[model samples]
Target chain A: MEQGIQIVSILIAGVIFYGGVGWLLDRWLGTMFWTPCGIIVGTALGVYWVVKKYGQAR
Target chain B: MGGFLIPLEGEWVSPGVHSFDSRPLFPGVLPDWVNGHLAQAVIGAALVIGFWLWVSRRQQIVPTKRQFVGEWLYDFVRNNISREALGPDYRKYHPYLLALFSFILVNNLFGEFFVFMFPTFSKIGYAYGLAVASWVLYNAAGIKRDGFGHYMKKMTLPEGVPIYMAWLIIPLEFLSNFIVRPFTLALRLFANLFAGHLVILVFVLGGTYLLTLKDNLFYNFSGGVSILFSFAIFALEIFIGALQAYIFTVLTAQYVHSSISEEH
Candidate 1:
């Protein structure tokens, strides 16, 4: 069940990050290519959150 | 071999000529000599280039029927990406930029999306290669346009910032403008493709898993749901694939435009 949930979350994250970022990049930069950049930024944000929480746990 | 109704399991191996671990990347090795990913990418590329060459064999003022289709696609990217992103000087850059758009569009659409089970763009290396190409092109163009010193200055220091804030803003600006942009450029494509492939994998595999569960009705229901979702995502993948390729190409052009324009 945990794995199932994780898969769901990842899929959700993938869709949101890909679609949202692509939309934002197109709007902000006037190009759809920036969408990929948004994904990278979102992933960085996710990584930062993980790192910060893991640090707090330690 | 068993009858057609029964399913079979096989070991995993990498997709192409490149061996992941001497086994087939996805069950049922395609024989050692056959290069899967490379063949697909190369053949896909060849087809696009060949089709254009075949269509445009003779130049025309008004364009023949076959040439019209090519012209329309070229014009679409030219207007949407080149002229739209870079503004005035886009005409000068249209040919190469058009090639980039078409190559990526075709590769992503046909090579990746049309494959049904496997999208070629899902490969991380392909995305990285594109990123590196983009990074090199923009940086080189910047340095070429305004010398190294001017280029660095434009990247590192902003025009309107107060003097005292230089200590703070300069480093942050440099990091965001120079360092993070290209890094994310590659990662953006890589992560999207990677994650997209994984989602499709999960649903497809889940469907298979449920189907294998001893003729249970619930399993059939879930399997049906998975198939429907998989097809839906597959359609969405077509849009995502083309959109990502377009965005990447245009952004590269935008970076070049910003760099050469000499204004903030």
Candidate 2:
């Protein structure tokens, strides 16, 4: 349960943080693609993060 | 089943978020903010302290019942949580982990037991308070052990990442480690206990309403089932309460362990 919460928080946090940034950029540039870009990048980064922290031989 | 739940003169009301409200213990005699939760919190803390003190004061090498119970609790926290997480440096943080686990366990059990019958952490503010304390504790321990510059660098910058990616990695790490860690920590505990208590209230209140107010015999049987099933809910609540307390304490130890470890 604890590991599940950790993974979910990282994923959700990444989305929210980058998505908010993308949203601000979209408002400034008057474009819709930035939000999607931000979300994808955020999710990838979140996955990479989990892999880095947990995928290694400890 | 209680008359007080149905009220004296008003129409029967269903259990809702209003059930979680912390009304003043004495309406006009004292401050309006002096509610049952505050009193109960104090009592919980007092009981934790008193129990540990009483149990630990007269420890027998052979171990009496009190000594055995105290030793078991302490060993579980110290070994299973602290030592398991913090490695050799677990001793210093053992006291905090023990206290936090015991206090939270007591407060969560308040929902199932008599007198209070309310889980204290259901209040988001209180949960946030504990989270903040934990945030301060882990950060303080990390900075103290690794120095400010070293600790910040370790937290925001994972090894083997290129310097060019620092712009992206820095903010992400900062947000995750500094912001989201404690946020999720508190919310997990609060949400579990809050939802569990709400579930119980639904069963108990709806059951009571069905049994007493309705004229039909079917409603009475269903109400009896609901009330009986609430015992299962109560058991589930107790399990959840203990689990939340354990998770909260384990996460705390994890944060501190990660912070103070030789590696980032």
The top-ranked prediction according to TM-score is 2
Poorest stretch of ten by lDDT in candidate 2 chain B: B1-10
Number of the predicted model whose lDDT against the real structure is largest: 2
The models' CA-based lDDT, in order, is 0.64, 0.87
What's the lDDT of the predicted structure labeled candidate 1?
Answer: 0.64
- Listed per prediction, chain B TM-scores read 0.82, 0.95
Model 2: residues >4 Å from true position, as ranges? A1-8, A27-33, A52-58, B1-12
Residue-level lDDT of model 2, residues A1-58, one tens digit each, is: 4456557767777887888899999999999999989989898888887776667786
Each model's TM-score? 0.69, 0.92
| Candidate 1 wrongly placed segments (more than 4 Å) | A1-58, B1-35, B110-117
Error of 2 at A46 (Å): 1.7
Candidate 1 per-residue lDDT, tens place, B1-264, comes to 235424523332223323121223344545553446656667767877888798778979988899898778877888888888778887766766776666667666652344534455567676677777777777787898899999989876647656875564454445555655565666666666666666666677667666555658897788778978888877777788788787777777777676777664
